[model samples]
Target: MIHITRTLSIPDSEIQEQFIRASGPGGQNVNKVSSAVQLRFDVARSPSLPEAVRARLTVLAGRRINQEGILTIEAQRFRTQGRNRDDARVRLVELIRRATEVPELRRATKPTRASQRRRLESKQKHGDTKKQRRSVGPSDG
Candidate 1:
């Protein structure tokens, strides 16, 4: 079982892994051995995640989550398949850990009077600079 949070735990059965050739670094071994790990988890079907967590995970995953609601993570940092597999699992745990955290609600606050004054002051200064650069009228003489 993978523990996402105190309240949420995902079973091993839900995760699926696929092995494929890693694209970088390892020379002849890269061509011969499949070192990359592709970890797939179905966000829509996971019983472990709460509804709110699932919703946030979907948004966070962005393009990684397919239309079918599968979250795919690829790890190919290591030379050996075992290391790659471990890397993939670690990434999955980190992602779930992030998803499990509830974000603090932001309290809406209006701009302070001081801040407003400062903004206006800056604008006025900019306007005064521009005004000085303007061509003077013929009547100014």
Candidate 2:
């Protein structure tokens, strides 16, 4: 089981992993060994997540989640399959933990009187500067 938070724990059976050859760091060994780990988790069908968390997770997953609602994470930073696998799991847990937090609601706020005055003053100052740069006309004499 992978524990995301105090309340959220995902069973190990829910995760699927596939191994593929990684392109970097291993040199000759890279061509022979499968070091990259592809981890897939069904976010839509999972019974472990709450509805709100599931929705947020889908949004957070972005391009990682396909039409079937499976979140795919590829870990290839490490040369060893074990390290890559662990990295994938840790990333999944971190993503889920982020989704579990409730976002703070934003309250509507008006500009302060001082701020509004300052904005108007800046605009007027800008306009005055532009006006002074205009070519003088004979009628002004």
Pick the TM-score winner.
2
> What's the CA error at residue 133 for candidate 1, in Å?
4.8
Q: What is the Å distance of residue 93 in model 2 from its true position?
A: 1.1
Off by over 4 Å in 2: 133-141
Give per-residue CA lDDT, model 1, range 20-51, as digits (tens).
Answer: 99998988999999989999999999887889
TM per candidate? 0.83, 0.89
TM-score (C-alpha, index-matched) for candidate 1: 0.83
Model 2: per-residue Cα lDDT over 1-141, one tens digit each: 999998789999999999999976878989999999999999999999999999999999999999999999999999899999999999999999999989999999999999999999999999999999999999997
Candidate 1's error at 76, in angstroms?
A: 1.2
